[model samples]
Target: MESLQALQDFIKTKDNFRNFVNSSEVPSVCKTEPCMLGVDEAGRGPVLGPMVYGVAYCPLSQTSVLKDLGCADSKALTEEKRDDIFRKMLTEEASLNNVGWAAEIISPNYISNSMYRRAKHSLNEVSMNSAIDLIKKVAESGANITEVYVDTVGPPEKYQAKLSEIYPNYKITVAKKADSIYPIVSAASIVAKVTRDHALKVWQFKEGLEMTHAEFGSGYPGDPLTKKFIREQVDYVFGYPMLVRFSWSTAELMLQDKAATCTFEEIDDELPKKKVKSISSFFSVKSEDGAMKRKRHKFFEERYLSMDNAFE
Candidate 1:
């Protein structure tokens, strides 16, 4: 109860926060012993809330400690179960003496800004960078990190190579389903999932929505409640509050069709040019009726179905 209250109180104190972190105080736990660390993330797909990255570490020889605590794939556990495990990690001396953890919550507003930047940083880059930062933080805090395991959705070769290049002293392995296979990764997953769940649970809407997060559902685009919120709670001009990732196509399409079109920046006046009789300009520019009528050539179309548009 004290830990949960402390978390909520920390959440409430930030007024202009874009990104924030929660970290352990580098407990004197096995400080001189080599350790293994794991990294995982949650809420990457949700469009309505902050995404969280978490890392957990413990002495290399204390693998049994985590096993005894029932650290398993977070997806396989109920929310209540995950919460119980995390709470145990906080309150139990055996667990606390062997484990240390940290988390970073990347705000939706920050995600939207990165995606909409002039140079446009892709979400994958943003996520990878966050993971790297967390691992680096753990290592720099005097943890003798000898190995790292990461859970990934993309191919593992590139991510493994990057981390290995930076921390060659550590054995870095990036793999799909790692959270299920690795106890440390599973611990990280629990931390991430619980943090994300609570973040949405205690969300304080700056825009003053009268509904709870339960009413908005899980924030997945397919969730009927989330779809309803995106479609019905729109602000028309400002769109949904900053809680929503404005760059998501779900929100973009909604704004394009249902709300006034909005742009982030101002543009200079159009350049003067001699009138030409070219016919392709009609296909390239907006029509006189203010509609984009040119259908993309059937063969030369975008072949992917992903929202990470910043990545080219």
Candidate 2:
């Protein structure tokens, strides 16, 4: 029995070791060719927060190291785990450089349109521009970048066109799930999410908003709490705070409601005498058959009757 138990323990340990080895093995998806950059964005849907765009670059030689770092899609990881991995990539990994573009206080009205539209107009543009800028800087410093992959916000073709216009020298590929397919984009996503989350926390505290049980996770328009807060702020006439985006539909709704409540009156230099036409004379008209047809309209009478009743 003791010998059997020892054998079982040895097998279990060996199996565990094998599992670790498999987990640590670099993913085979990364191209062996040198020079690829990954790009992604976050906070595109948030009603209260800024849109964040991120970009990360990795040389071909370090692709295996990044894969071994367990880099995957940021959406697959918890906030804590993402932060941990992001920090590890930044410090321990030599090939990755992550950068972010944040647009603060984007209006709720903008969110009513498609998120992809907003991302394309704002975050995507900023991120791509910044990424190109970084690539140019790196190239000037003698670093060669052969290719870039962006997790497309809008159609893949649109991103491809934009990147082509921006960076004519390098090859750019825009795909729907580049974050999952490319480790560099995943790394950028991790950094972007972490940065945005931190910014949201700081904004919450600064705005005197309670974060506890707030359910304001990311503050997207879909969040009930965000909608409620928007309605309350607008209804309370908080004077369009800087934290709130004036371009959002929430703000427009509030403005419309305010407009509707205002009373309007006209001023005149002189009062005109009321003209009254006899109902019988007004209704008397000749028909096609030459017989007088009397048509009595009750709408005016009913309105006058209601006014009389109110006065009484």
lDDT of each: 0.83, 0.55
lDDT, candidate 1, 36-103, per-residue tens: 89999999998788889999999888898888888999999998899878876666453455788888
Candidate number of the best TM-score: 1
Clashes of 1: 0
TM-scores for candidates 1 onward, in order:
0.82, 0.57
The backbone clash count of each candidate, in order, is: 0, 5
- Candidate 1 wrong stretches, greater than 4 Å: 15-17, 92-97, 263-267, 270-312
Which whole-number lDDT from 0 to 100 does residue 134 have in model 1?
92
Candidate 2 per-residue C-alpha lDDT over 1-312 given as tens digits, one digit per residue, 9 for 90 to 100: 112233223323431111110001112222243567666767765657555555565566666756666678989988778766655543423333222111122222343332346354554454455555544554444445677887887689987997788789888988998899888778767656765565455443334555532455457777788777666655344444444555566666776775345545655425685777787776567778978665545985666665457668
Assess the local accuracy of residue 307 in candidate 1 as a C-alpha lDDT between 0 and 100: 36
